[model samples]
Target: MGPPILSAVDLDKSYHSGSAELVVLRECSFALANNERVAIVGQSGVGKSTLLHLLAGLDRADSGEIRFGDRDVHAMGEIDLARFRNRHIGMVFQFYHLLPEFSARENVMMPLLIAGEATGAPARADELLAEVGLEERGHHFPSELSGGERQRVAIARALARGPEVVLADEPTGNLDHENGLRVMEVFERVHARHQTAMVLVTHNQELVSGFDRVLRMGPGGQLEQTDQEAPR
Candidate 1:
């Protein structure tokens, strides 16, 4: 409905391990429109996660610029980048990186607290948990929840910061078919309700089909457009 919410230009990332340079992503470029759902699919080592990291400002690229509206994420320093990411991007991972010590409510509240809005943290956390279908389980810790439930909590946590873009890395990698589908349902709900642009890195074809567009990664830093409609 508007100009691109996120754009990656000539992105490249490489790591020097010992004497060899391992180039993970090369010249990868793409644009994600506002409220768009996009999937990144590829081989294990093709750098899907690396690309997500760069886009989410979790890491830096050797060359390239990630634009979120008017801000160039690559140019932000550590403090500004952290603040910018907290306010503008939400991130989810396959492992359900919830703290074992905190209840689901507290876990989701962590991001809000970090952003210095502790007063309404619990109320907002509860609202997000309910949205993700984890209202009754808000008192449970990570170890007490199932894989799907944990991911639901993670989804709630990610949305807690009220970000414009949500980046998920291998979100369903550790779940069974039923749980994975349930987790995906929650993702869809989040996207629809928040109108947040989503960039999901998933190897599961079924999951990839849920997005508006699919981008495939190839060796030597190639990104090719695949399906452009939501799979039915």
Candidate 2:
């Protein structure tokens, strides 16, 4: 692999509580190469989400550096960071987070709309819905879709801006086994089709098996490699 598309070094984040400080991450470090699909698994409350936030530049670390390609994400100004994130990173959450008032097509078009590409939003959104097997359901509202379908919309929304990376946090947590499997399949297929790097924070080992690598977060915010290759 060439230089990492994403890299973090000596990351540290903490919170103040009364007179004490609660440390979330301590010198956390990792790297993700282009087109790599990686899983970070650990028990709840191990700062898995925090790590994801810091990596995505959704949150900042008290100390350390987060680099995307060669640029320092932490060092960028707010506007530039927002633009960079929109253009380079996409995020999917366990909760679908769609607009209840919008149709599936409209919901998927949000990123493009925010990016001021209104003219092409409809076409791109329709294409993504079809790619995720939701073409016929484009007119449906969030309330009209199943948990899996909603997540599919969320995934399509994440890809709306044609981001280089997709960061998913417990994406299948709300689905049943069958639907969860289907969602994972969607993620795999989308990543393959787009050649986008993915950083997935999940507790499900089955989902982790399909990834290129798995890293487990140990106590004290240390990361250990679990797998070097995807399972057959």
Which candidate comes out best when scored by lDDT?
Answer: 2
Residue 108 CA displacement from its true place in model 1, Å: 0.4
Model 2, span 11-97: residue lDDT tens: 998989899988879999999999999998888998888998988899999999999988999999999999988889999999989
- Candidate 1, which ten residues in sequence have the lowest lDDT sum? 223-232
C-alpha lDDT score of every prediction, in listed order: 0.88, 0.91
Residue pairs in steric clash, candidate 2?
none
The local lDDT score (0 to 100) that residue 204 gets in candidate 1 is 88
TM-score versus the correct structure, for each prediction:
0.96, 0.96
Model 1 per-residue lDDT tens digits across residues 1-232: 4799999999989999899999887888888999988888889988888888899899999998999998798899999999998898899998988999999999999999999999999999999999998889999989999988999999899999889899999999999999999888888888778898999988887765668888888895587877655754
Q: Which lDDT value does model 1 have at 77?
A: 93
Off by over 4 Å in 2: 227-232
Show model 1 residue runs off by greater than 4 Å: none
